[model samples]
Target: MLDWLRFGLGTLLMLGGLFVLVTAVLGQFRFRSALNRIHAAALVDTLGILLMLGGLILLAGWSVVSLKLVLVIAFLWLTSPVSSHLLGKLAVTLTDHPEREMQVDDPSLTRDVKEGD
Candidate 1:
């Protein structure tokens, strides 16, 4: 009974994770800007990974494997956002845009620059 429940839960989580992953991939192509792409990447970092972790935990049952799975999930959750942020920052720094050049005089960019300087 419990085994059946665990299997069912695991399967559901895996399916959900796959679905979110597919959406994230599609979003990368659908979004217009780098910022939008970053957001889509973040969805994969959080939702997709969480679902995968949940599925793994359910599949592994109560064991060291389950504990390790949780640890992996924790590590991913902790690092993915930071990594994504760094990538986004790098992308913004490396890319050139005429509109953004015009916005250099904008208050927000000026404030950000002053803060960094």
Candidate 2:
């Protein structure tokens, strides 16, 4: 029946979200640099959140709860990336670690202008 299909899909989505969240946490500890950590955080923000939202939507069916759930998901999707960018920028600006190397190839991080002509 439709109910069984919904339950199965919801369960799968929730499990996938949890898996992504665990990997993100592990990645934070395993990675050497802030940039790498940011990448892992982004994975959690995108995949983990999306999967969880999908699960919630399936569980709620077409109710008002599902509508609110979608709004929350949209807000998170918008804010998470912006917050990550700000945190990464702050880390790069404030930290003074010699061993810290950029793992993500950000053009802004690499682009430098010469002063003298």
Candidate 3:
């Protein structure tokens, strides 16, 4: 009975994580701006990954492998936000007039976009 419950719970968690990741992917494609895309990427890196790893840990039970999974999740929790912030900073630095850059079809920015600005 406990085994069945565990399996069901773990499966649900894994499925939820997959759903979150898919939503993140869709968000990335829907949002036209690079910064908006970063928001979607960050969701996958943090929440989606955490859910996936949590499900794996539950499926593995209280073993060394589970401990390692916990460690990995902890590491990701610690690093993901910092990495996202750095990437956002880099995007801001590299792009000129980011808000204006959001409008891809703007004729005035056509040359700038072609130049990879």
Candidate 4:
């Protein structure tokens, strides 16, 4: 009974993660801007990955592998946003009229940051 429960919950979590990842990919194609696509991709980087790793950890149970999965989740949680921020900044730096899309107070601010002054 307990094993069945674990399998069921793990399967559901994995499927949910796959669904989120697929949706994010579809959203990237559906959205028509770099920032919009990046925003969609970030969903996969965070929630989708978490769900998948959580499912694996559940299946692995109390073990070294599960501990590693937990560590991966923590690392991803720590890094995903920073990477997303850098990507967004890159988009803002490269794209024309990015302030309209990103709601930046001034696009020139991105330039000033890049020039190191």
* Strongest candidate by lDDT: 4
Report lDDT (CA) for all predictions: 0.80, 0.80, 0.82, 0.85
3-115 per-residue lDDT for model 2 (tens digits): 99999999999999999999999999998877779888886768899999999899889999999999988999899899997776666655554234754355444332111
lDDT tens readout by residue for model 4, 1-117: 999999899999999999999999899899988889988998676999999999999899889999999999999999988998888778766776665665667657866756652
lDDT-superior candidate, 1 or 4: 4
Q: Which stretches of candidate 4 lie above 4 Å from their native place?
A: 99-117
10 residues in a row with least lDDT, candidate 4: 108-117
Cα RMSD (angstroms) for every candidate in the order listed: 3.5, 4.0, 6.4, 2.6
* Of candidates 4 and 3, the better by lDDT: 4
**Clashes per candidate, residues 3 or more apart or on different chains:** 0, 0, 0, 0
Considering only N, C-alpha and C atoms within 3 Å, which residue pairs clash in candidate 2?
none
Give me candidate 2's TM-score against the actual structure: 0.82
- lDDT for 27 in candidate 2 is 93
Candidate that beats the other on lDDT, 2 or 3, i.e. the better one? 3
| Local accuracy of candidate 3 as per-residue lDDT tens digits, 1-117 | 998899889989999999999998999899887777988888676888888999998899999999999999999999988898778767766776776856545655544553653
